[model samples]
Target: MRRKIYTKEQILRAAYEVVATEGFAGFTARNIAKRMGISTQPIYLEFKNMEDLKNELLDLIFSKLKNEIFPVPHTGDKVIDLGLNYINFAKQHHNLYLALYVDEEGGGKKMHDFSFNYFSTLIENDPQYEGLSREQIQTLHTGTWVVVTGLASLASSGSINPTQEQIISLIQRTINNIIAVNETVN
Candidate 1:
């Protein structure tokens, strides 16, 4: 019988599956190998170590979010769509969400920076944001981030299972209030 050889992509995908379903606590080479029905040799051969594989996995997941997940237009409102996508992702992939956002050492800072920049860019192009200064836009981004991240964290933890309408209303109202306050302040 010939040995089964796995490419780096295949190994990385298997690792994703492990992390997605089991979270970082179970994110181990042994678990990944078991999920792939292969020995750990293939994983080690493709990557230098578990940390190396983890960094690559983080990049792959971020690429998926930036390219595949968050880019999809929904509800015709960029901010609404972004918030919904984030909440849905947390709801659907609770373990992965917790792993990526909840764990302090899980590169949450990188994810935060990426998300803030992405949100800021969206605001820059939005007509509603046209008159807002960069500082105000940053404030809006921070406010929106608080609302969205709070909802996502709750969703990931199963603390609040709100309907789509409730989630949308909450996000919209919070954003409106923030804008009102920002306008009043300046």
Candidate 2:
């Protein structure tokens, strides 16, 4: 048989499939080759090593998630949409979400930092949070992060099937409570 030449992208995609289906524990050259029905030689040829492949895979996953998962249909309210989008992502990409958030080796801290910085920027811009100082906004961001993370964890674990409306209400309430407590404390 002629040698089947696979592009780096193809190998990376196969690696992604391995992770998506079996979690990060299954992310290996052997499994990637099996998924693509090719020999591990192709993967080795396309990437420097498994670590390089893993780093590239992580970049691809982050890009895919940032692009595909972060954009929510406008609810005319961006802050509420942030919480909704997070839950939706967990529901849609159960294995990937759990692997990233539930499994330590999946780079949970990286995800958390990325999430906080990203959502905090949006929260800073929302008119609803306009009068809050930067410190207050950061406090609110931390609180919102906790709420969103908990909801996402529950969703990923299949423990909760919350409607969009219900999630929106809960998020709104959480934000309000955090702001109220922050204001009271100050």
Candidate 3:
């Protein structure tokens, strides 16, 4: 019997769904093939190895983040909404988010850089920060990214047990502190 040709995109999509739903451990050629109703040979044909497929999945996750989570407007408070959205994404897509940021090497670095770029862009474009120096704006952006990422990671991992409201409050306090310090120095 002739084997049906499978596109790489099809394989990646199936693999992503499997990883998202079943965690990284569930990402195997056999499992993906089972899900796709095909044999593992197609996957091997498309990807050099499991690691290559996993890296592509990670890249897809980052693409999703860029499209979905990172475009949130600053709304006069850079930290609050951004942090809320970040935590919400993690909680809502626990397995996928964990796989994207936790289970893979270099995942954290990608997330950190993506987050920093998002925050920096927001700060640079906001009219409220018109008079702030570039260094100050960069500092604020980095501080906000750290606080939000830390809180989101903790919340997602169950390391911090707090209601969403409480988490938001803590984030607000951190942002307020940063603003206060910036004010005093300026």
Judging by lDDT against the true structure, name the best candidate.
Answer: 1
Question: Which numbered prediction scores highest in TM-score against the true structure?
Answer: 1
The digit string of per-residue lDDT tens for model 1 on 106-161 reads: 65777788787888888788886678788887887788778888999987788888
lDDT of 2 by residue, 29-104 (tens): 8999999988899888888998799888877877776677775665866667777887787887888777776776
In candidate 2, the residue pairs with backbone N, CA or C atoms under 3 Å apart (3 or more residues apart, or in different chains) clash, namely none
lDDT of 2 at 24: 82
Error of 2 at 33 (Å): 1.4
> What is the TM-score of candidate 1?
0.86
TM-score per candidate, chains pooled: 0.86, 0.85, 0.74
Which of 2 and 3 is ahead in TM-score? 2
Model 1 regions more than 4 Å off = 1-3
Tell me the lDDT of candidate 2.
0.79
Model 3 lDDT per residue over 72-172, tens place: 65444655767777777877788877766677543567666766677667667778656767777677777766776677788778888678678678777
- Model 2 misplacement above 4 A: 131-134
